[model samples]
Target: MTTTQPIGVAVIGAGMAGRAHLAGYRAASTMYDAGLPGIRLVAVADIHEPFARDAARRYGYQRAETDWRAIAEAPDIDAVSVVVANPLHREIVEGLLAAGKHVLCEKPLAPTVADAEAMVRAAERSGRVAATGFTLRRSPAINAVRRQVTEGPLGRVQHFNGHYWCDYGHNSDAPMSWRYRGGPGSGALSDIGSHLVDVGEYFCGPVRGVRGAVLSIQVPDRPVPLGAAVGHSAAVEVSTERRRVGNEDIATFTATFASGAVGTFSVSRIARGLANALGFEVFSEGGAATFDMSRPAEFTLADSAPPADSDGYRRVVVGPQHAYIAAGLPMDFPGVGHGQNDFFAWQARAFLEQIAGLDRLPHCPTLADGLHNLRVLDAIVSSATADGKAVTVQ
Candidate 1:
């Protein structure tokens, strides 16, 4: 039974990605005309009061909260976006779910697979819509490529080469934070590799095993921050002490999919000259398709049986005809481009749609998917630990 009452929404982080979730929720209703109920920008929460207030004021939320529990306790809040640190996910999510609030959590579900499994169980027992924030899956270009490969035309995907590279950890002076904590495969692999793994599985199929994995740390230690750090930005002031970086800054792995597709994946936070360079190529018996997040508006397609004298890739500009294009933007034309943040809006819409019972098959990744992603990461870590020995995904 769908209610016409406005669905109250809250966000539990006031950092970089949290702000994106705030804007996404504000723009969610405007993206599509699924007769979604009005959304209430109820509250913005962060342990840092000032940040919370800033985000709330910037996004037109009703209030700011320093305590996330306030959101769970509030009767008016129907849904929440948990964008806090990875270690804090399980407790907050469990509390919110117990309060009967639908949740949308950012990726890497938790620091460990065991934690993710517990969260999944909590979501199941609560009977609430628990979604993982695999934001890249909302890209129109990526979805179009997925359709081509999974349906036909790209018949029997044989191989997938994907990489997500960033420069966030290039600066050794960057202060120590939770992002650099945990064991091997917990840093760059979990930070960005999770997205790559999810996309690889989304394109081909579930990863059956992983092998030939390597994890490396570029900067071994960083100065302790003198003040509270937000997101990945380095703290302006730092103490004389330095902490040892416990995880890898770069990760490379080979995966075998259940559908006989082989995948080569790489992720790095120390890749110089690459801000968010996520791109992938899927090769199949019939054809191949490639997409670069840097060029969000288009994809390159190579048909095996091209017309005579034309045996190369052709650029395909995504237009309103593509998935999430029609009614997804105010100007749904081909050249009118969208960015990473627009994905959060699309994701928010999908989450809200599921909450309203407007759709049975949710477009967003479920808690189960999130757990599976962690398992894949665990396999990579185990492989790297065992001298690159093959490790089957649990």
Candidate 2:
């Protein structure tokens, strides 16, 4: 058998997520004794040259570039991580795939259904592995919930309820970024609702239809940055400017999965006092199971068949023995505890393995998943505009 060297990876963003991916790659390299069969960080790319250079130096990459195309077309680059803005996802991913590089893009896939569909076609034509950054699906605790649900422990899934609320964008003075904009898939829906949609589908199945509402509220006008504030050195009158905030800050939807399971989901960026509360509950004939991303280590499983005396939800502790756990790894390791679990490394390793022909493509959220999410998101938006009329997922 011929042994292949580690695949070369290029990350094309220097934002928070880009940093996380870099950290993940470095951690994986260390975990595998710097000898993982097929994966290595070869280059880092960002529009900010200094940030890219800094990341290269800190992450031990051999090269850094300001233009993503340089890394996308480099012969040494086998896979590209698209961590740029949502508007850039389709262009960069399409370009990388056209250049014959495998791609792992962050979520929402693209700003629209058409672009996301194009990305799917490109991946199909390239015959290269393509994965989305739906890291929550790989969580050990969530994996346990999936197993229990699939094993008939949850019985026939009848309903699902979920909330993904955070305060990161709650402050009125939160600076205006791509996330709060209208174009380029900005807004709370694509930014955070995408994850909740992915989570709902990952756990319940395909969402076949939706009925929901989307709303945006303003707390304050963000002050221009110091550099831009020189001309107008005062806080600009900031109100809930609906014209400036085009996308919904709050999204609530009721959906029916392909499996006939009904569900209700809510995602918000302005929920006061909530700091990253992504949670869900599955109710079935057998009982119910609940999960909260904030509390990464445990899930609640309620027994349906009870004598009524000891009937209650039991917390399941995800340990090293869990299906998603890597052998020889500690259960309480920082990565595992923080949801970076082996799953994060597994995503990179799995993509590398697929490219090397060592394994069939492992399921991560694919372009098809992105399409499904987009359709559902569209439905939710339409329903909201039409005053909560039920809308079928197209």
Candidate 3:
């Protein structure tokens, strides 16, 4: 009744995002293995050999290489996950596209807008499945909110309030790494703020312009690591060498959507006692809905119903009726909790469907979407630097 095809997959950059993508492929291969063909974890490439080898064994890859070009040119690899630094995205993506491999690149597409636009153009002409990792879109809560917005439970968006807060940079000795020094588009805005930007568009519509912004570095400088840095907090190799942080550690911005709905967004990497505490509340003429990633399993929503009492938020446990839940878990199992990796596996399934030429799945964010997000990040920076002056996105 259904057709299945084998796919060869490789992941570049064995860092955090790289590990997540590779593991997702493994989970999807087994969890959603109905008509899905077995995927070969062909290889993993990283700048560091230890990183590559470690990820390869941990993720069940067939091989590991220090050079990403090898994976790009590997004849056996049909699909690639570009999970490297933002500065390296455009070149690696275009190269992989030229080799005719389907690519799912990590978000904040590139360190600059021009590079992202170029990648978009390359993806357009390559005729391959090109996806960007705005992976949070796969969350069931996000999908539930989207359904409400489109189905009229929430009428027209009037205002959106969102925040992505983390305590990773609250420490004084945090080492400076690629994420901290990836030039203009790096830092809190592009790091976590990119997800907020994407979620904003998903909740309302495309933001037409930015009305104001305040971007600041919470920690003025961080100790430089002399050796290989690991994770968010790594000890410097016997040195107190420090470097100035070039980007904002926090960004607060106001945006106006094309439909004239206004919104405010705040992102902070130095918010103590919180890790990945991202959430949003949208107010529409019809009603309001709220979501928090910390909850992961449920969201609070309300409709414009006649109030007699009990007119507060309604807690929705993500079940089979919600998006992508049945694919990863038993929907009938009430009170079942979902985690972030579940979202990643679902995203992998979507990409597999994309490669299979199925149009019913959620369209993974394209290079164009990534570029638009970059523009929004850019406008926030511009607005912030100009002391909160409005900056229009073109």
Candidate 4:
């Protein structure tokens, strides 16, 4: 049933990515032409008082909340975005779902597979619109490449190579926090590789197994923070005390897809000179395509139909005709650049649309898909633990 009344929405986190969710909800109504229900910016919540207050003021939320429990218990909130820490996801999400709120959770659904499984079951019981945040899939160029793979021209995908590199952990002076507390695949692999793995599966198919996996800890220890650390930025007053890092800074592995395609994935948070470098190359029987997240608006296609002399990758600049572009942008024209945060807006719109029952097929990944991603990541870590032996994705 289409929602007849405005959906009351609140965000439970007020930090970097949390702010993005706030903005996305604020802009979700303006992005598409669907007669979507109006969104009521009810509240913004954070443990830090200033963060919640600032976000509420900036995003036009009605009020600021210090506890997420307030959002869960509120009669006015119908939907909520849980953009908090991974370890806290299950508790917050379960609480919200039990309170009858539709949830949009951040990726790496939980710290472990058991937690993810529990979340999936909880979402199943709620019968609410529960989604995982895989915002990279909303990229117009990436979706265009996915179409080429599935809708012909590219033929059968043979190999997929993806890499997500960033410098968030490159500095030795960075403070230790929840980001460095996980084990094996929980580091860079889960941080960004989760998106890469999901994108690979979106293009080729489900990964069956993984081998030759390596998880490395470039910085063994980090300084303890004397103040609150926001997002990936280093803390300003880190104490002299250092803590041992419990997870890898880099992860690399080869994967076997169900479609008989082989793939490679490399992710690192300590890579030098690369900030938000998420890209992939797909080699198929008929053609090949490449997409770099650094250049979010276009992709390179090497179609095999051209003559031998003209056999080179052609740059395809995304336009209004591209996926999610026609009505997604204000101008909705060619060469109008969109960035990473725009993906969040599109994601918010799609989530709200699903809740409104305006679409048949799901536009975002479900909690089950998030569970599968965690399984694949667990398999990768298992492979690394077994001296790079092939581990089946269970």
Q: Model 2, stretches more than 4 Å misplaced?
A: 1-3, 30-36, 183-185, 226-243, 304-307, 328-343
Clashing pairs in 3: none
- Give the per-residue lDDT digits (tens) of candidate 4, residues 1-394: 3576899999998989999999999999997675888889999999989889999998999999999999999999998999988999999999999999999999989999999999999999999989999998888999999889888699789999999999989998899988989778878988889999999998888999999999999899999999776688785689999999999999999999999999999999998899899999999988899999889999999987779998999999999888888878888989988999999999999999988888832478999999999999999999999999999999
Clashing residue pairs in candidate 1 are none
Which model, 1 or 2, shows the larger lDDT?
1
RMSD of 2: 4.3
Segments of candidate 1 deviating more than 4 angstroms: 360-362
Q: Which segments of model 3 are wrong by more than 4 Å?
A: 1-4, 182-185, 235-238, 330-332
Alpha-carbon local distance difference test for all models: 0.92, 0.74, 0.85, 0.91
Give the alpha carbon lDDT tens digit for every residue of 199-309 in model 1.
999888899999999999989999898887778887568889999999999999999999999999999999999989999999988899999999998999887667779
What lDDT is obtained when candidate 3 is compared to the true structure?
Answer: 0.85
TM-score of each: 0.98, 0.89, 0.95, 0.98
By TM-score rank, best first, the candidates go 4, 1, 3, 2
lDDT of 2 by residue, 234-315 (tens): 2334344333555667777788898999988888888888877899998887788999887887788987667789899888
Query: What is residue 161's positional error in candidate 1, in angstroms?
Result: 0.4
